[model samples]
Target: MRCSCCQKELINSLTLQELFFSSSQRCYHCEQLFSKIDQAQVCPGCGRPNSTELCQDCCLWQQELGFVMRNFSLFSYNEGFRQWIETYKFMGDYRTRGAFVLELTEALQKYQEYLICPLPLSKERFEQRGFNQVRGCLDLTKRSYELLLKRSELAPQSEKSREERLQMKQPFELNVPIEKIRNQKVLLVDDVYTTGRTLFHGAELLYKSGAETVKSLTFAR
Candidate 1:
């Protein structure tokens, strides 16, 4: 397979071990540039790499919201990872989805009891993009649903600064019945978790709808 980032032919073809243990979507060079969060040195709240304590943002979340969100992030948002997102999400390179499917599939298996929900894009954005970037990356064998809906149009979160993003009002609504998700653990899936504002908003709604717990899983943070 070709490298997802550079589009170069992979020098080492996928091995049985690689197919089983690692995501061989990108070549060695590209793969090395994208670092996974070290399980040991991560923030308990956000899962950011190399943090021994709850990051300041999450501490604030606990203070203001009275609870800390438990989030799992798969990768650090490094330069190479940014390029991967640009290609897959902005440029709409569908093939890039294959690179992370194995990884996501493996991660999601642990949350089998939770209802999986992808963060919804605004109607205009969905029409323009043709697919949800978060959903595109998932290769789930079990059932899932597009349960969240955008409450209204808004500027893309990526376009906003940290402060601006935090100030943005609630942007999502539940399309599914409250009864369906009531008392269920809900997993909010997104392509990236920047400031945690978006996911927190999602979690708040889920909680109000009677969810037992709300957590997020992002491809990157």
Candidate 2:
């Protein structure tokens, strides 16, 4: 299969997080520490440069896609990253959630007073996938992660075409109570941003809930 990162042909790769107990980066299990950066595109995890791509999800059905927002991804969805997602996403590797959150913390700390919210999983998807990948990243941040958006079980997003995903209407709402988020910077977290329909709907929901400025942070671009 094609890599989720560079969209290049993928080759298997090993990660520090997956090594034997002796090779553990261990950092993957701890809150990610920001290594400092001059701007947004450079990844703090690997310190790699020029790492930006619109993934397969973005290439299709981009009409309602908002261009004003910015996103920061932790790593390109290369073979190794794909495996990471698989292990944590499906095999009950919930411990990996902490590492992803640490990664997100270092990336999102720059935006102050932001509300951290996870992209919702349809009831069915949540049951099938077992855990929302967005939760993995949010655990590392000091900010409060509100269950603002919700997922619909009617049709699974994975089964839909990019256009179908884009056409998906607002299915999320604020589950945590907040009087006003107006003008407050809000960060919407998600495991990945393929078509971006999820994030767009999420940003709108935050705004409707009174968020002043809305920003998105993801593990991938």
lDDT of 2 by residue, 1-221 (tens): 22222234323453444443322133322212223223455433222335454433344424344434556556565655666667778786776555444345556777767767678787877888777777755654666677766665347778989887876666775666667566667777776656556777777777677777777776754
Candidate 1 residue-wise lDDT, 95-192, digit = tens: 77656665677788888888888888887788888888887766433446556545555688999999978766777777887788789998899888
| Deviating ranges (above 4 Å) for candidate 2 | 1-67, 140-142, 152-168, 176-178
Best by TM-score: 1
Model 2, residue 39: displacement in angstroms? 5.4
TM-scores for every candidate against the unseen true structure: 0.83, 0.62
Clashing pairs in 2: 5-77, 32-102, 57-194, 74-219, 101-137, 148-173, 150-172, 182-210, 182-212, 183-212
Over 4 Å off, model 1: 1-25, 140-143, 153-168
